[model samples]
Target: MKITFTFILLNLCIFISAQNDSINDKVISYDDKIILRLNLDTNVDDYVISSKELNIKPRLELNNQINTSFGLDYKIISATVSFAPHFFPGNNNNLKGKSSFTSYNFRFFPKNIIQTLSYKNSKGYYISNTQDFVSNWQKGKDPYLTFPNLRIQSFGGSTSYIFNKDFSLKAIYYQKEWQKKSSGSFIPSLNYEYLIFSDNQNSVKSREHQLNLSFDAGYYYNYVITKHINIAPFAFAGLGKKWSSYKSDVTKDEREKQNYFTQNFGAGIHLGYNSERLFFGSKFNYSGNHYDDNGSNILQNNFYVLLFFGYRLDPPSKVKKVYEKFQDKIPVL
Candidate 1:
């Protein structure tokens, strides 16, 4: 009887081991697939504005941006780049307002560690009723001045560790620092500013410059909806310090140069479906950043929406070659 019992236990252990090995192999195959992604559609990038001195609360509104992105992915790494052009349909004579190279991110996953290198350009709307700021607004010719946009650019990298299949933590760092510029091409326009409040009303244009090094840590939880679908929700909050310089274009002089502390907090949700040969997802995020100087503050609430579809790129070459050979038979426009 003792020998029979020992034999049954040994067989059960072997069966469990085989099942675990099969699961690992399936996961590995999915991770190793090479995939291509196409962007379907998206809404205008929205921004919210607020101020302490103006008694105006923050509000979210769509901007005049049309954005598109292309991406490629594989087991070890993934890359994405986006271009956004500001457009106004009412003004047929007006040129495209500005072409913003939105974001570039390269992400890598090696076992439990996830690494990311990213560059981002963000825009925020500003509204003020103060006499000083309004005076500057009335003098400007750029239409963007009435709804001023703050352009902030940053290049940074982040690292994260997976504690388990359901949980992870991430930390971000920026070596170069975040900087602010006007809403134009790489080289700003002469009188492109929408608002400028200073001692001299002769402020032909103005640009706000910021130098900030920030750090943030966040937690993400992956909630499984099905074998192929999952939703990951995350939350984060951070603090940093920045040196700001407000510059007047004509005089080439700095109006206000000061250092202040800033705080940011946000949360987002990500939904995705994954298989061995295909992956697709969509994400929506909302964040608010604020900094105060004297009696006024620069506050921004930002929202991001992205949709992506990816499939394994291993197309049949023989079939493609046959189709290409007979392409001349098809009618052309």
Candidate 2:
């Protein structure tokens, strides 16, 4: 009977050991983590992933390819709107919406670089820039401003590089198509700046300019309010000269004044708020008297309710959200 009891005990021990081993072997490995992600018809690329530390032995540094086995398990759909007024101090009406899905699988680890590419096509009633460009209602004579039918088709990419978590340089390149536009080509650009404010250690100030082919020196700051909301406020003022020369028929009887000392000296500020998911954004661009109505000297204010949307087949990484829940434990240096 003692031998029988001993035999039963031995069997029980083996059974328990086997069960534990199986559990370990079957559990998902963090090294097999998905680093890249994509959602159906979504604007922002959410591939901004970080080390999945909670899961044990993150597979951040692996040579595995992206895995697509999960197949459309979840999704997100939403909409948004805004109001920005005539070049400044007031309000303008705006609105928007979309539907999308997200999925992932892989073991790819990258440190501080992220890129997002997307495309979105939306149709709505907008101020006419496709037709008449200059019209403004004034107190007496019309306010001598041009607002054309603004049917714009824009395509662009937003990219970011973090020299470190504290210092990141980001920029956007866009080519727009307006049914009927203005003097400037379809080139509209924005930079995503993340810099240390009041740190005084960076020693790098923000720079900006309207003049082409000339170098101007400047300061910038950026913040992410939430997963889908981001705000970047920057101030820059600089000096430069116009590189392009225009011929004057009135001055020299059609002689071109091709070379002259053209200086643009002014101070300006930029306010940008973006909703990554919906690809919605607002910008307040104000500069101190540097541009004119028709090429004459006059103080001007150029403002817009920047409406843009695009879909990204791939997503980008944003470390802020990924680390938010763990912020208490992280050193904020």
Candidate 3:
């Protein structure tokens, strides 16, 4: 009886040892510092910009463009490059002009610090009605005319610190160095054509330049509805400056340049489903800037909706070979 008991005890010990060895091997096989590649993301954003000086009411426009992004994820850094391809037929003459878009985003995550650097050259069509010079030529009564397409090229960066999983603080700066550009509408046929034209010029331009900087605290909470579905809601508020120049190409003397301090606030909600193979999401955000200038309050409201889809890809043979070469150099401790 003593010999049988000894045999059973030895067998149980060997079984536990083998199980521990298996767990250790599994942990050693995965390197937390490795990078992932071949991730593709598709995004579409519909943007609306409204200001009292631009239109009687804000016009919401579908950009009708697809933005493609390619990203790489390393240990604590992620970088992505995105571009919009203009291949589809467009009916808007304002967009028929030259256009280009390129964006670069870099994210750094080291413990509680999260920082992002972004540069973008975004070109889009904008419409504004001609100012009513004569009482008979009423502004806001006519159709929304298109002219002076906007090309906003900016370099900006933001830094955020995560206090916890659901809360963070952020600061952003854009166009620190003021750059000047022209935006406005072309000459349109109104009842007072003679009054609208000066020095035989048929076009009206507003030479504009601005700087934007803001700081805000944000709260985001995620609710998991299922294994693959989740929803997130977020809100933020901040203040910034909107220094703008409003001028006419024909009459430079009749220009107005003002430095206005603006307060901004925004909120959004995101709903998405994420899985190992595919990911999709939709988000809607509304942001507004309010300030007082010359005894009148000016507010610029911007609303946008984003739809995104992404796919995951396995490492190709060439990528695997490079990864193997990198692994071979690591010394076993």
- Please tell me which predicted candidate would have the highest lDDT against the true structure: 1
Stretch of 10 with least lDDT, candidate 2: 175-184
Candidate 1 C-alpha error for residue 139, in Å: 22
Candidate 3 steric clashes = 0
Q: Which ranges of candidate 2 are over 4 A from the true structure?
A: 1-212, 243-278, 288-301, 314-333
TM-score of each: 0.58, 0.30, 0.56
Candidate 2 residue-wise lDDT at 196 = 13
The segments of candidate 3 whose C-alpha lies over 4 angstroms from its true place after superposition are 1-70, 88-100, 128-144, 165-207, 243-257, 295-298, 314-333
lDDT of 1 by residue, 1-333 (tens): 233234433433333232111212112243333467766334343434445557655443334434677776643446878655444342221222332337787765544445565666655433323334444544234333232344556555544444543122211111000111111111110000011222223435556655554455556655556667766677877777766668767647546788878787777877776665666778787877688778666666666676767677553677455544664453110
Error of 3 at 35 (Å): 9.1
When sorted by TM-score, best at the front, the candidate numbers are 1, 3, 2
Q: Assess each prediction's global lDDT (C-alpha) against the native.
A: 0.48, 0.25, 0.45
Candidate 3: the clashing residue pairs are none
Put down candidate 2 lDDT per residue, 24-96, tens digits, no spaces.
2211212112121221211121111122333221111111112111111111111222112123211122211
Q: Give the TM-score of candidate 2.
A: 0.30
Ranking by lDDT: 1, 3, 2
Error of 2 at 212 (Å): 4.2
Instruction: Give me candidate 3's TM-score against the actual structure.
Output: 0.56
